[model samples]
Target: MVDRLFRMKTKSIFVRLPLLFIFFDAVRCDYFPTLYPRESETREIKELNGLWNFRADMSVNRSQGFEEKWFMSRLEKTGPVIPMPVPSSYNDVTQDKSLRDFTGWVWYDKEFFCHYHGKDRGSYTGTVYWMITTNSEEAKVQVEVVDADSNTVVMGEGIKGQASVSNVKLWWPYSMVKTGAAYMYVLKVTVKDSTSASTDIYRQPFGFRTVNKTNTQLLINNKPFYCHGVAKHEDYDLRGKGLDMVSVAKDFNILKWLGVNCFRTSHYPYAEEIMDQADQQGIVVIDESPAIGLLQQVYNLTKALDPTRLVTFASSNSNPLSDHVMNIVDVVMVNIYFGWYQDTGYLQTIPYQVPPTLEGLYKHYNKPVMVSEYGAETLTGLHTSPSFTFSEEYQKDLLIQYHQEYDKLRHEYLAGEMIWNFADFLIDQKTNWAYGCNKGLFTRHRQPKMAAFTVRERYQKMINETQKYQN
Candidate 1:
């Protein structure tokens, strides 16, 4: 499998998908991929992902687990046991449908071997970090790092926090530093046993990396990074939004193939595992919240969890609300569908429409602006005379115009331009929808469309031009 995966290059960027499934399959553990080290601390990250001892209190009326301190692992033998897979939804794992829907407190238990070696054992330095997620306001979650004697090493409240300790390790991505091996630590997430607590403890394994921004560019570990990828959606047949490792690995491989360096989680945040994989591959992700009905609180939370990246809402239209929201964000982004959805489908219209939108944003906000999305839906193999909607030639030509206009503006005010999607994906079947939206550079199964080559060539040229000017 390792030999089957090869490398592709475009100018200076070396693109390769390091297939780690060979080791992942053997160990049955998933690595949580957040770069959490603040440079002052070295941390050890362990993904408690495989089979965990699970007990679901379906009674919908019990609360004794919290009062009795069930999170301490002392009550391991107090309930019926079933081996549950970590990093998976507990809904479809059982034969009983009620168990799938049973929303009470589900207890998960796992023990991992931790090694601490220091001559001065009293001053060991380490920290335990994990992400705690919940859907209900009434839900209560707690985490504890315990020793063999059930002594609490550290404890915390809320969904995601870090508990500092002594004598630990640091995680590095394969792309960042190839150490030939990866190390991790263990974490336990628990909740109160009650009808109100419909809880699932997910396994998160993150490493140490820092994200921050400059006036004109994004900085990873203090180095400026230019995003050159597409807006991606979590849509696939059969699985829908369910976590499928195969599709994810394929997506990473395709992103590498494009020679692009980054992508935004379009519309919403992606699965934790996907973020982990992105971390492992060193792919920069512009994590987004929901499109509409979204609150500033959501962006606040995302920024709080990952402070290295900026949070900007994708504004489609110019309005007071959007203008007000953009004022509050770290960056300004707009999703314009002009020349396809609004204006005439003419290339000349693009130059007129795009520049003013960006210039207006720059004038008012004085923040870096990016074209988050801009594309026309084009069906594969379809052609048209003047480049009409749903035609491959139209999609190709429309992108060509948009890119040309963006090139002229990017140097001045625009920071990046992410095409609507990398691939055509599953969508709700409706009257106006043609099978699925064909606005992708590739088909749903990862087949390249005409626009794919167009994008690749344009990206390569852009990189070469930037390099020449920089030199």
Candidate 2:
């Protein structure tokens, strides 16, 4: 396990939510439905996405605590309880504004009833399906959906076998079923640490969807299509997950108006409501992991070439091992900050490969891997020397560098790319790097920067310059 030192960044977004237990207000908005219809695929899903239990473990308690049997046993005896909510960060339970620091290990659990009325039109196999997910390489945990209301346990099984084992029954997008029927599916996630355990269980809705990527393309129902999608943020001005349905619904309306055929959840996963609206709108999703803002220092590649590193698959699919369970491209959103920061030579790290690693993640996960959000930050740092300045010469070179790099993978592995941003939004303004100019194809309001026109012309040309094959 890579040990990432947990330190709250001086300016982080987690600090937005207020730490307080306010009375649960009463304003009834319909809960997001988890199921829809797909003519050639499965439908009907239950979304287990409501209140869930949560807890975070400090690192010190884990690494050193793992060696002591008594200490480990003591933690297992009483699982830690953090907070409970649906589809938000685990820090929802604490006052630690920066959920980044609470990263060691966390847990979530919930309970529900099961109901799989009967197989659909064909291949009617009578069997129950259970699915679980976590961050640990290998986890030992059990989930039980018991009906204490009726004094009976419906589904109670420990999940600790392998990655494929967990993929027993996968959900495909617009193919198999739109949703999974859960009369009541409760969840209990126990992310075990050496001497500390974080467990969260609660009632929420969960519907399964299977996604597949193939033939340098992607399909929702075995149909080839181009996904004109955007990586969206929660709400431009809302604080925390403090979004209202009216706002979410409005975004959906905007998407429909814009003629978007797909939606990628950017770097992080999103709330259940967002997924429901997308499915309903027939918008395909690249559904990326919860990662963004690659503002970091770069390191030099060790001169010694290690074959192991060369052959490892770079599937950024939050769950590297869940390959069998869900189709997700492990995309590396290469930005100037994420890797090889200061090293001007690091740009040569293209065609990065790890042996026969799925040839490419899109093929492996049956999904197109996108450079969803990437571009040289216009203002990573200012001109240091007398002649150094943020000039068109510098910008042209920087833009052309990444464009040329990804261009090689065009017919090879990559699906497409979305520049760091379309326009400088509210978030960029908050960053220290913002000095009127930063990451954006357009200015803050909506004016296209010179680079914007370049992106349009280059991208449109790529679209028009497709090579046709003859057998």
Best by lDDT: 1
Model 1 CA deviation exceeding 4 Å by range: 1-204, 291-294, 303-309, 319-322, 460-471
Clashes of 2: 54
lDDT of 2 by residue, 373-458 (tens): 54444543334332122433344455566667656655565555555554444544445455433565544433445565566556
Model 2 spans with C-alpha error above 4 angstroms? 1-211, 215-217, 223-230, 235-263, 271-283, 288-369, 379-397, 425-432, 435-437, 443-447, 459-471
Clashes of each: 17, 54
Choose the strongest candidate by TM-score: 1
lDDT of 1 by residue, 1-471 (tens): 122221112112212111121211122223334534222233333344454556676554655565555564423456654545555666664444677677767776655443212112123466666665566666777876654334555678777788885543333222222231123443557665457343455434544344556556555434444567799889876667677655665577567557556688887789987886676455667887664656578777776876645778788765533555777787788888888788756666887888887888777877777888889887888878877878887888889888888878766767778998888887889887798877888887777777888898877666565444433
Query: Which 10-residue window in model 1 sums to the lowest lDDT?
Result: 10-19
For candidate 2, the TM-score is 0.35
For each candidate, give its TM-score against the true structure. 0.58, 0.35
True-vs-predicted CA distance for residue 409, candidate 1, Å: 2.9
